[model samples]
Target: MSHHATPVPRHRAPAQPTTDYDVIIIGAGSAGLSAALALGRCLRRVLVCDGGPPRNAPSPGVQSFFTRDGIKPAELLRVGLAQLEPYETVEVRRAQVQRVKPAGRTFTVEAEGKSGRTFTATARKLLLATGVEDELPPVPGMRDLWGRGVLHCPYCHGWEVRNQPLAVYGQGKIVTGMALLVSRWAPDLVVCTDGPGHLSDNARRRLRQQKIKVNEEPISHLEGTAGGQLRNIVFQSGEKLARHALFVHPHQHQRSTLAEQLGCRLTSKGAVWINKHSQTSISGLYAAGDTTSGPQKALLAAAEGMEAAIAIHETLTREECPK
Candidate 1:
């Protein structure tokens, strides 16, 4: 019998806090940590606050990332945090930032630590690396099997269950496209429209021509194994379809309310609008990663963080220089 070893969990040790810093990062995920490394390399006083669960904490491993492909999501973060240890200028705190307020040229951020104590810190610039939250379907047992059997992006999870009996949980017109996308991995596909969708007659005709099954009956619930691995789809009519995996298009929103609280402009897709340099509409505040518009990937988020950090550093340098 072949045995697989379980990866050890890594924890971030809290660092002593100071009253002021050059840059205050609101998240400690890929984007925030990457930005901290960039700023710390420049010897800028930076503090990173990590409050809640990481978005990819449930994912088994990251994919398509150069060199780090197939690495466990938690392990990748552990490596990133470890890289920051050499820089004394970068301080990390395991706390959730409760609120952020603009104070003249600086910003005041209030955060609550794990100990139930609240504290405040002021910074010349702020980076909102807080990623978005995936809103799973309200179907029973769906949330439990989210990253496992109930998945979102096709590029992310399609290959894992490739060639198996697959189904797309289509809820809207947008999901009609997702159903087609998933067809690339599993030819034997079915589009389960939980209810009547916005799909036009032409789209329905095309889907049928492709021989993909479309079931519009409301889903009663998802049946899964004890480990949350999907087994079958149970419908309102008491009919069940054997399926190994389910693809879904979920609604996403910013994990933190700080962006909305700051009056930052949002894109039509509901993400924070950011310029090429990752600067938000509000001066002295910037954003990166899933909070901003674009494809959401760990490597891409890290690159965006690097860009934002450089922009923040240059802007601060030009202003602080005695001209």
Candidate 2:
């Protein structure tokens, strides 16, 4: 299938001012689409709002996803959206959700389209699959090489760069941990603290035991090839360390504030906290994928979405049956 094919058809008309949808999914990534598939199969009305490109858009392809491994990120989503077409009860809108308001049991969502048109949608339950945003280092050339030479997840990009010269960017115990983890893929690894690694004696010993070199010099900037692949790490002292790839554990924050807007509890890491059923602290509000805590992977996010849908369906069933 052509990757350029329209994932979801555009709806020119405004959403009706009624709470007709059983669930309002705020994201159209793997998680949201998986939930829609489950809910749609259950004969429930679901509205999935496509909030534009996902966090992994910069990546060339999705890794470690069973069967679909190495598929382009956009192509994976296009396949997901295409699969939902058979379910008439499921509708997808390409809009940016701005705010979510709670009305007793139901919830009201306000979103704006690309054409500057605004619309309101209401549903009995809300699912937030909105992912997180990676805050890359301020060093030059970092963003340009993101998902290419500057990768964060080892499992996702390690094999491709295995046995190649690599570097882990961070400081203190975090960098220590990352260096050790990344060493499994590349024996030739170094830790670039960018000045003052803040490492404990034990941490340094561990890294030394692993034969990982530590560089405390502040990085002047990263040098990359014309194709955006990392070439070397240039230090302030005018020294350059040749490296094929650099791994980092960048800080992250929620991509959307809808969870906070609806008063959902959040972990210290800023991910939406959820119960076993994928329901958030607030009743009837569900969250899955990178929005919630734990390992962030496409396959795992899809599983979480399916679990959340099953729970939501059971909850709705209980309400209707009234045992």
Candidate 3:
């Protein structure tokens, strides 16, 4: 695809444009925000629309995140907004993007909610930073207590819940592997599949060697304490097990329905496909963060965003320069 031409008067954009934008970014999370920051610095007349919902929202503190470790997710966004102010070239809007369509050399974007509006970006490029959503088991209290006691990412919440009695719930062998890794942090662990069978025999032996109990009991439901901390898990046979925390392997789904709607190719992992430069299949379009396949770390996403922003700068500049 041809590189996007820079938007005309790429300053702080007007309220709404009749033609198109120079660039419209569709997420405001770490990757999207980082990309916006770079573009704003380049003076690219950029607008970022984020629903403000990120996969990491459930956890109180983000660990292994370099200098910003142990900070609330919302607090990071606050800092991003403040830093972005210096550029005077980026505008961040809180909106849930519904759809995106490329027409000729421009694109039309429709966003929804009190945060909803329709506008055309006359500019030549697009960036998607929308993240993913985790699919948790149908336990009574799991979803409500997601980022709390019932956690998905071990690296993020493992240290906090380390050394505590933990319950590992999973379906098949995938859970078995996770149980082995989790046992490293918490010695006392219980591995169970609510249904008939998932883990194979060889997998079972490794789990047993590690002293992690593998139970094949059908789970009736989960029981939690007042603070939403996972307490005792109840099995179908009225059996109960004591646990302070429940670790799970979240089945994830891409939250960017807009990507599919826009014909962006999706990989097997459900992430938007991109080149090393973060450029997607459609020319002039780019993606970063969880939306792109690879690692799901916040720090990594930020780096990818910065890289994509640089590419955006080069591409736009090259396209706009007079021949």
The models' CA-based lDDT, in order, is 0.88, 0.92, 0.82
For model 1, how does the per-residue alpha-carbon lDDT over 200-244 read when each residue is reduced to its tens digit?
887788777767788888999999988868998999999999999
- Rank list by TM-score: 2, 1, 3
Candidate 2: what lDDT?
A: 0.92
The most accurate candidate by TM-score is: 2
Which runs in model 2 stand beyond 4 Å of their true positions?
1-18
Which RMSD does model 3 reach against the true structure? 6.9
Instruction: Please give the lDDT score at residue 224 for candidate 1.
Output: 94
Model 2, 217-274: lDDT tens per residue? 9999999987779999999999999999999999999999888877889999899999
Model 2 is weakest, by summed lDDT over 10 consecutive residues, at 9-18
| Residue 68 in candidate 2, Cα distance off native in Å | 1.0
TM-scores for the candidates: 0.92, 0.93, 0.90
